[model samples]
Target: MAEYMRLRQICLVAPQLAPVIADISAIMGLDVCYRDGNVAKYGLENALLPVDTILLEVVAPFQPGPGTAAGRFIEKTGGRGGYMAIFACEDPDARGAKANAMGVRTANVITHAPYHGVQLHPRDCRAAFIEFNHTDGSDDILGPYPPAGPDWQKSIRKDTTLSLTEVEMQSPEPEGLAAHWGRIIGIPADGPVVKLPNNTFRFVKGDSEIMSGLTFKVVDKAKVLEAAKARGCAVKGDEFLLSGVTFKLTA
Candidate 1:
């Protein structure tokens, strides 16, 4: 298999799936692709929406406590940090081994037939959980993403939100954090940004290290902002706060 990697999905955590999922769908004009029942085993419920080809997911723990990792993540960051950045790659095991060699422990390894994923410890990863996954015999960018459900692509709506353009990671030492993430993702940092095949990860200075914001290309910036305001989101300038991260709208 040829070596390649791209940001496949971005996960966000919320106290409840409600208004977060509803607000994002309403404001961005996105459709809910799937609500994975597989997560119930972990005492959680999730909903995934297609932001173009990339999946945008929000997970909330129904049983909120130390028993679940999602619950612990919410408490640790006070629900401020984004949960995970999942990448579709050629080899997940090789990537996990590389991260392990660098002292980053593997938090979990999930395998369900064709799909295989390796999640690195969020504490060691700093900003958020880093996951590398691959689906057997599916190398095409839009092909069989098990996590996003069987017909996720059918729900793709580009009328309002076109695509997820960038992910903004914030840390006190942005440059260092960028370099660290670059090493893990095997993409060398260009100053404070790691440019990927489909999207860009930009690190900026902040009080703590976390995935702070997401930038999106939309059809009409004003319309999106209006929808956000209607949904009771904290809208300011060309951005809004929903599910603990800023949604920056762009042309």
Candidate 2:
């Protein structure tokens, strides 16, 4: 059953979704797919990209409550956006059952007529939201989402463009956090990194995004920093702020 789960999407939540979307686009030279309607009933708005058939979405909440989900996330971590790695399942209902059997409760379930998605509590994953969903009336997993407006393929076309590889996680106790996430994702602890079939998750002891969960790919790390600087982006170590979002580069 665990093998049946597949990587689906990566979401980044911000206080203002639009600005973050714009920031990533300018730095990456890609366009975002603005869906026609809200994906969540919680007043969350989004923009998406088809990153190797895995949707990458940036989302934000319109209101407040412990942080409108998106808002709450910003308040908790001070707006350093990270990935909310979603997974595809054979059956969302059965997945929910599995989670319940494991004593994990679904955070929110959405039945938006044509699509069904459930957000697992962040407490379950720590530092991120994990969503599972199966759409109705279509096997077009990435098709329903719009094109990212430009030839995103071109960004990767360059030999220097490294794939925005894996996300890293950081906690007070690196070993404990690694083991905990290993159980959730069915991956084993490999030294400081938890090795999953699709992605490698590294765990460290720190609160910074550079030490914690961050999105990376295979671009000329130095070149990305240089390009970001040319665009008036603020740099802090390897992480850069452009448009209002942060992009961290790693091998």
Candidate 3:
């Protein structure tokens, strides 16, 4: 199999899933694809929605405490931000090994039958958790993705939101953070941007290093913004704050 990697999923952390999930679905005109029971083992409850081919997931800690990673992240960020950037790759272990060599410690390794994933430490990764995963005999982008659940594609709705175009990673030292992420992902940084096949990661100046925003292509930008306002989102210009990240809509 030829080697390749792409942004497969973006996971956001929330204290509770209620309002966040509801607001996103209403504003973006998206449908919930799945709520993985597997996460319950880790004291988490999650919901995944398909944003074109990219899965958008929100996870909340049911058992909030220092023992739960999600709970700690919520307290650390004051309940504002994305959690992880999960990439679909040809070789997960190889990617983990490379990240480890760069002093990015491996946080966890998940293996369930045909699927395998490696999660790197968030502190070392800088902004968010970096995870590389692969499913055996499935190189096709739309093939059997175990995390998004079976028949996730059937729930895809593009009436309002067209596609996720860019992820905005913010840091005081934007260029340096971009270069670090580039090295981990094996993609050389182009100035302050890391351009992937389907999406781009734009590093920008901010108070702290974090996944701060997401840019989306929409069928009707104004309509989406109006929906966001109705859902009581804090709207400013072309963007609205939801699930702790700015959702920027473009026509």
Cα RMSD for predicted model 3: 0.8
TM-score, model 3 to reference? 0.98
Candidate 3: segments with Cα more than 4 A from true spot? none
lDDT winner between candidates 1 and 2:
1
Task: Return the TM-score for each candidate structure.
Answer: 0.98, 0.76, 0.98
Residue 118's C-alpha lDDT in candidate 3?
99
| C-alpha RMSD (angstroms) for model 1 | 0.8
Give the Cα-based TM-score of candidate 1 against the true structure.
Answer: 0.98
Per-residue lDDT tens digits for candidate 3, residues 142-187, read 8888888888989899999989999999999999999999999999
> In order, how many clashes per candidate?
0, 11, 0
lDDT of 2 by residue, 191-246 (tens): 66776545567777765432244555635677767766777778888887542244
Query: lDDT score, residue 232, model 3?
Result: 94
Model 2, poorest ten-residue lDDT window? Answer: 145-154
Rate residue 23 of model 3 by lDDT: 92
Give lDDT: candidate 3, residue 49: 95
Runs in model 2 lying further than 4 Å from the true structure: 63-67, 81-83, 112-115, 135-162, 208-213, 236-238, 241-246
Q: Give the root-mean-square deviation of each candidate in angstroms.
A: 0.8, 4.3, 0.8
Candidate 2 whole-model C-alpha lDDT, 0 to 1? 0.61
